[model samples]
Target chain A: MGPSLLLRAEGLKRQLGDRLLWSQLNLVLAAGDRLGLVAPSGAGKTLLLRALALLDPLQAGTISLQGRPPATWGLPRWRSMVLYLAQRPTAHGGTVEANLRSPWEFQELRGRGGWRYERIKGWLQALGRDPSFLAYDAERLSGGELQLLALLRALQFDPSVLLLDEPTASLDGATTAALEALLIEWLAAGQRACVFTSHDSEQIQRFATRTLELRP
Target chain B: MTPMTSGALTISDGRLALSALLILVNVGLSAALRLGLTRSLLVASLRMVVQLLLVGFVLEWLFRQDHAPLIVLVGAAMAMIAGISAVQRTRRRFAGIYLNSLLSVMASSALVTGLAVTGLIQPQPWYDPQYLIPLLGMVLGNTLNGISLGLDRFMEGLRSGRDQVETALALGATRWEACQEVVRDAIRVAMIPTINSMMVMGLVSLPGMMTGQILQGATPDAAVRYQIVILFMIASATALGVFGVVGLAYGRLTSADHQLRLDRLVG
Candidate 1:
């Protein structure tokens, strides 16, 4: 593994019951890499992302972050560094700010100096939202707004690698562009990388530096 | 039948048969109302009578035995049955559910009952079947209910709220952090019945053991003291039992790697 490699997966395999989804899959993520994943429906794209984040079990494979296996870093720390963002995000019954702040309650993230309200407000501004957006009830937010909230929630944690699964499916074009710009700015700041899937080919071409296709 | 020296009335076989005939009234009502419960009513009544009679004979024999190990064996058997019945009452199950229930029910009931028998009541020989058996039975009964309700709620909550749980996990929440709310909800639900019963215990209804003791010629004051102690023991046992079962369930449903292992759950 090179010093620039952020994550690596080797000989990954997954099977759903009696049917084989995929096997012998490999991925390498380096710093500032924006890797777009393309796969047909039922091609196990989401499962691949989940497997990379260790959210779901793998039949046979090894995933390492910064050349260290998950066992050495421990599950919580490993997941904190390599986070997954779901397509349809869920929010607890509280204000948007509460949803964003919820991740800090975990012991693994507690010592990261906690979330900065000003930094979130700044991100919200970049996403074209005002400060009062934090006060809105999270459960009552529209789908697009919820997606923004989910993005903010993950971004605030400062993860090393983000596995985004159709994060902008519900967002309109303008909001989606803002989100992409925000992500670009985020990538430029640190040795961060992202693996995302988009149904829109134009968006993928515009955003991803390179692309990987999964054939069933 | 002969009356006891304490003047407690003894029911003869003929009188007991007369009491058994009372179920005809339920059967008649069910028939008239077209409720279709007549067969079930009759079968349930018969089952209750047969089961109680068997238990009566068993208790009589058990009370006569002077061996401590035999008495302990019977208590262990009761706890085992209670444990199995607890899991059987749940709608959802996972692998190791039976073992989890057995460990929780047995440990909590035994702990509370042992403390009450040896420390508080201080019965002669400490394992006297007369005192230890009934106390253990009462504790086990209530603890079983708590474990069943707690486990059921925990599993159901996880199934229904999978999205929310996974959301938390995706954001790097630990297994306990992801599940703390459901675990709290389960424990609260399990403790509700016990708390409600305690609230209305004396005013709403005289407890069964108290009534039985009074009928057996014990003074009302002595029976009341025993009932109070029994109530306290039951509450402690139920709290501990609910905690134990919920904690065990949390372990089963989540992994050390901070993953939510919902696949381990089965209907």
Candidate 2:
């Protein structure tokens, strides 16, 4: 069989007020899969992404992490394994490192432990920044820089699936290229999967090995 | 003690009428500015006068009765009214909102007021109307505002900061972790006015309760001591109320799965 599935969404239906965003939707992500979602604006790309991440509730659908229902896995544990990085990344006050450190402080994450300093240092270097970047004030970071921090924050968790909602929308060409390269290396390093929703067709063509097109 | 030995003065009806003369300024200003509030001002004044008169009569009758159950009944009624007023001020709607506010009011008022009356004041009978009613009234009033302000701030914060909260949740936070910042900020905002009032009490102005005691002939020394005691009582009551209301609202707005139930809130 193909590589074992990391996450699956079956018969997913989303409704916004009287409008139906999507119905009878099915999606699957196997290990090392780079799944891209292409949709016109307001096609519920973000909603679908959030629903998979369990940030938004589905009208009538069940999301399974691995082969089991999310309820069996526990929400906090399931969420840690399937992280959602929003389009417009933001952080509370403190240094960039603090933004990364905050999640570990949660009780759910406390028992799971934290990242090694070397891995974060290596990720920063891979993103074309040095270790000193950790000292940058989170609130003072530019939009592009905040996106980088957001990506690194979730990546450090070593989730099985990464749902990126227009993750590179604010990045310049060089940063986007760097981020894409880093993500490719990360996926290759483990049996991880990634799903992205972006307007950039070129980025999709270059990055996504499989594509799901949605019509409004 | 003899009449002069009391060392207190009472206002005669004529002097009280002279005090009423202050309303003419409000009347003239309303007319001059076309504020159109003259009717409202008069109605408010009339309501205040009538309500206070009725309450005074009721209290006189209550003080004469040595029955303890009446004190409990009146205190319960006062707390119920304060709780409803607190909810009205917030202007938020949810299921069992009355119970939400009422539980907080009763818990905070009972715990703190109970402590002050039994531990400090210790009047002859535990339910002495002279001590219990006024203490309950003041504590209830201050806590009503605290809980209201706290609930309003919390609801508004969650409504606006939905994304931030969800982001934290998606990153593996429990509902408590996701909303802790908003909760703390809201409660802090709720407590600020009470804190500021405490800071400026002696310097800025004598509080109404103290001034009233002084005007009615209690010595300044005794009034100041009583004011200090009541200030502490109010502070405790407000903190307890804020704690109770925030806890309840959070419990109401979230579910066992740690979902933020924004749909539960009504416009």
Candidate 3:
């Protein structure tokens, strides 16, 4: 691995009870790399993504950020840079604005300071969300809306790499295109990278520079 | 008015024999309704009789002892037994729960008992067995309930809210911050019974200690004032016990890297 790589995992393995989810896996996300993770249903695509994001423990492997093992970089520090966005994320019960503003209250993020409303409103606008969307009660939002808010929260944190699990699965075609555009804008902003798991190969062809497929 | 003392009234051998009617009523009802509890009723009654006889003899010896250290030993033994029972009542098993519960129960019981002997009850010679035993028993009993309720809620909450906890961790929150809500919930669950009892203390019914004190020929005013102190003491002890156990569990249930060691939780 060269210095260009932002995140890497080697010989990764995960298990559920006595059943093996996957074994002897390797993954790499470099600067500006768009990696598409494709696998059939029940193939543990989310599990692998979570493992790469450091949300799930590695059964037998090593995950490194900037060539440092997670142990040395520290989880909070590592995860702050290498983020994972779940398929269906849960939020603290509040308005959309409150949900977006919540993570900043965390001590780790506290040193990074708070979210900027103008910047978030700009990002939300790129996703075709109006300013009023921020004021909407988060509990009442639809699945797609929730995903958008989740994505927006992740994007605002400026993570260098993102493990997106079925991020656009619930969005309509127009919103999906807007999400792609928003992601592109995010990538273009800095030394950023993304991994997306989607059934839509067409979206992968357009968005990801390469793809990894998991077999049952 | 000065408090009057009455001679201790003893239940005679005939009266003690007549107390068997309580068991008879249960057995008779089980047979009449086909409730199938007759065997359990008989066993429980027999166990209670034998256990009480042994405890009575032991209490007699404890009361006779002029030694102060005997008080500590007895209190510790009671706390250990209460701790075991508290952990046993939790349907879920937690790693290192025995130590956690035992420490919490001992700490709360000791602290509350110390306060009682030093200030509130102020039994002369402090280690006076009569006051120490009953006070320790009451503190241990309430602390036991609080700890069991806390352990049950904390484990169940962590299991059910794993995702939420994980999400918070991923967002760079520490383990304590991530599980803050669940910890708060555990405290609430543990404190509920004590709170409810306080609420209904005098209005709905007479409480146990008050009833016993009144039956022992204490004036109603004295009984009521003692009950007030007792209610406050109970609530304080329960909070301390619940916090000690639940707070210790948070450390045990997570790793240094802020990951939840949910696997540590057994059946």
Candidate 4:
């Protein structure tokens, strides 16, 4: 049998007024699994990602993470373990380091729970960037730079589950390839599981252990 | 430039020239900045010039007649214009709702200032052209600014960061709890400039009313007393007008269910 399921969704449904976005959806993400969610524009991929992150309420049925129902888990605890990277990848405050370390400001990260400075620096280097970028203003960063920063921020949470929406949509080819290599390394480490959505089929085939498509 | 003497323009010679020059300088600076606000600046300048000239002639006529109803009519028209100006400055998602908000602002400001000046200050002839017109204008104008700032910031906060706001809601936050951050920011921004201006009024700068009074040859002590009274009236009017319009507009922007009407905004 596969590793114990880290997340499970059953009979999940959402309706925006009269329009049904998703219905009767079922999914399970096991530990170490790298899952890719594919959908056409407006097929509610972002909504589903948000729902899985417990940022959006599912209209029907249930979702559980690590055998605890979302209703049972404390909000801060749930969010700490399940980091979500939104599509926009925009950060609120000044400086790249400040954005990357935003979770540190959260009450949940108090006392030995802070993101390791060394690990963050290492990751930045791996992404072909350095400590120099950390001092740069977040608003001044290009889209690709912001996207990478957002991914780095998610990783800083030390989450058991990472949900990213089109994380590479703005990246250059070299950065995209580097991101794929990072994903492979992350999966190989077997410490965290990831679920992401992307339009590039080649990247999906290379990185996605299993893929699910959201239909119109 | 036309070789024209300043006195030929109107009865109040130097004061008119100064006000006109100040307005022209503001307009020129706005154009230089390429703020895409030339149309608004031009229209506002034209409105101020024409309105002041017309009001001057009308007040001259009213003073000669010494009739109360005609003076009250002028005040009412000024209040109406002030209300409309407040609404135009406020950026709302549903622009159609601005009319109601504007009316609310006007009513609140007018009721507060009208009662204070006419009933309490009670200048001779109660509707004296000197006291009634300028005092009412200051109160109405300041209140208009507060109304605009409060409404505009509130709507902008709702529009931009909508996803985060909705996320808070989905996290079982009450509607007020979900919107608390935005509300706080908007209200703080709206109140700050007013508070700052009031704090710095006498020391850093003499306000427009006081300056006008000084220029018009009123004693400095008398001008200061009128300024103090007018300032108090304006502060009260601004608070009431801003609060009323914001409270009403906030309710109307959301449905009974408390979802933001995103599509309704032309912005």
Candidate 5:
């Protein structure tokens, strides 16, 4: 219940079919915290992120954002505040710009202000992408490019918490560094925090303020 | 052109048996091609013959009775059967899928048929079996196809596009917003057959109801008008039924929490 706490999970549990993946899990994220998750492959790292974002049902326990439960804020609002970025994010069958702007089409995010073109352009430039990248068909983009697009799509929404599942798995060294820098900058801007899983232990050591290990 | 006053020639039981001989042609083709469909063809043909004969006898008895309640009961039964058949045609099922199909079929068919019987045709009584039963049957048959196609397409689309749907949801979309595209595609798929049939109705082939009326000694002009009314009724009912089933599916597949409940789907 710290004043800077942005997200809290108490006694979270998850299972896939009859096999229990993890249980008695707890998380507390404070403003400007970059929490890295360490778990072996097939250990349900993605499921934990989904559970935190309310994208999947929780088998047990509670999750709250900024001292408020998901039910009180309602799903759309809660999800808007705590966004989950998947490793293989969907492109939505349109231009990259359209995919980025798609979230604004929802009434839930309308009041958050529409997508800003100049800001996206700046981010693209940082990621070594030209303005022409926006015109590229999202479905045809390479895996790394899609990951960038997905990141921008989430970043523009300015959510308080981000649950990133292997976000840089497909990116090369240079782009991964740039993405980490960009995320650091984003986290510095507000009472923001993120929990991310990285297969690369070096990247996790470099980026995370602290690490949480999930053992089977 | 002069109108012929002669009614359709009645076929005796012997002549009807003679018509059954045509199946030999299909049986011959199946045997010659080694298609191995002879047994299935014979069984299907027998079933069709028995089913039509039973329906004919039931219609005769139903028409003889002027009871409104009994006619309505028959209509409900038809809707229930149509609902079951609609679900049976889908490759996927979920809890309450049958109920969803039944409610959608029953609601749309009842609405369109009631409007047509009372508002347009205005038979001696609204539940007059001769008119109500046939009209309801036609509407229910078409609606059954529409709901089946729509539900199947919808469930499959959601299953295949699970990532896209979850992506939208994570981007702060409501359940309806996340599923709008799939729902639209499903409804469009459902409406295609109905629209295509309407497009080439008279030019491509004579409609069954119109041909039946003409065979029963009705003038072509009167039969054409009834056919036109029936066509419009079928179109309306099919559209409504597609929307009904797709809407219900949308509700079941997504939840108040804006989560995609793909776990609810049973393949």
Candidate 6:
């Protein structure tokens, strides 16, 4: 009967010099709620994703997870709980394996656990990718392939929240449907939630339980 | 009267002309390559020739001054120019910061060379242009390149893929932790050519320093000592200059909040 708070933003406003990007914006997400954020180009969708990931400075507002402010949660803990996947994944400019393993060197992951390289192979197989894809350079990956591989890598963290910016923009209809099913299954397995942005109305209609429009 | 011929040393007019001609050809071909770099090369060539000639005249005058302060001033100027050039090649905005780093490198480098030349090599009038100037020039030039490479890549790495950098920061990585890979990779790449040179110095090539020393009437054994010392001094100077520039430039490249100020790059 009562709403739970997984992530909450209050009175959020961002401005660059005299130009305001977003103002008086507010959002909240609870477990198992798959939300879609829709906006036109330059509506700061990507900026908002980054800001939610604690990767950008907010002009004014407070973001809280589980009722505790991010300042109190600390960056490492907050970021681990909310993994932001960009439209174009920033490949490490190296081999696929290197890109996948890049985050292991971060302070939060360092010495925490050893990578299960075999699980990576299984995930790739499940995603219709070959294990040998690991040997190829990231720069050589196709847009669709990159998004898929990046998704697999992000899942390695098992974050409670996945913030995806147009994750399937380059995917074909079949692949998009498959990915939607996969995401639904993932969210259904636990109370984890996902907030994503996309321009595909068909995919949004199929995958999103709730949609929010940020119009310019 | 031909200048006094000593030992196996003979400065032939034809040999000097040949060397000059080779340098000219190298410059010409490099400029002629239609690589959008012709203008920059021509400007750099003219600048180098004029600057070196002017330095020759100035150093000749300073060598006669017999004052320690004058010699120090000459060395300081050399260091300052090297630093400024290094900074310029790395995008040219933070001239003052890079100059300070360069001067620090030069002072340390010159101190090492000065001590060795005076104490061990015992070259009378230790500021002898024939010895001190050439050694300083070689060491400073190599170090300047290392500094430029390190600083350039460090800044570029930070500016591009800034989100990934921030991701690392958000993941509780310290400032150094966030930057460790790019910094290490830049420094390693900067040292690569130098490392290869050191490895292949004697087998694949006759180094300019040794050849110059031998041509100037020094024995092969004596020349080798100077060459070895110069090589070690260059490595020291390069590492020091690179580290110094990277550390200082990192501050200028980033904002107070430790985020890279991309606007500062173009500004």
State the DockQ of every prediction. Answer: 0.74, 0.63, 0.58, 0.06, 0.85, 0.25
- What's the ranking of the predictions by TM-score, best on top? 5, 1, 2, 3, 6, 4
Candidate with top DockQ is 5
By the lDDT metric, which is better: model 1 or model 3? 1
Pairs with backbone N, CA or C atoms under 3 Å apart (clashes), candidate 3 = none
Task: Note the clash tally of each candidate.
Answer: 0, 0, 0, 0, 0, 0
**Candidate 5 colliding pairs:** none
- Angstrom error at residue B233, model 1: 1.1
- Give residue A123's lDDT in candidate 4 (0 to 100): 80
Candidate 4 lDDT over residue span B1-68, tens digit each: 11112222234677866766776666777788877776897788889889988977976676565677
- Stronger candidate by TM-score (3 vs 5): 5
The DockQ of predicted model 4 stands at 0.06
Model 6 regions more than 4 Å off: A1-3, A15-19, A90-102, A110-141, A188-191, B1-53, B65-70, B91-134, B155-181, B200-212, B247-264
- In candidate 4 chain B, where is summed lDDT lowest over 10 consecutive residues? B1-10
Per-residue lDDT over A1-216 for candidate 6, one digit per residue giving the tens place of the 0 to 100 score: 654668888777767667677878888889888889887888888878878876666778888888888767666667777888878765668888987787777667767674679878877766667788998888888999889877877777777788989999888877777778778877777658899998877767888889877632
What fraction of the true interface contacts does model 6 reproduce? 0.32
Q: What is the C-alpha lDDT of each candidate?
A: 0.90, 0.87, 0.86, 0.73, 0.92, 0.74
lDDT of 4 at A51: 75
Q: What is the alpha-carbon RMSD of candidate 5 to the true structure?
A: 2.7
Worst 10 residues of 4 chain A by lDDT: A103-112
Model 1: colliding residue pairs: none
Candidates 2 and 6 compared by DockQ, better number? 2
Provide the DockQ value for model 6.
0.25
Candidate 5 chain B least-lDDT 10 residues:
B1-10
C-alpha RMSD in Å of predicted model 6 compared with the true structure = 5.8
lDDT of 2 by residue, B40-73 (tens): 9999888987898899899888777678887888
Error of 4 at A141 (Å): 3.3
Residue B34 C-alpha lDDT in model 3 = 100
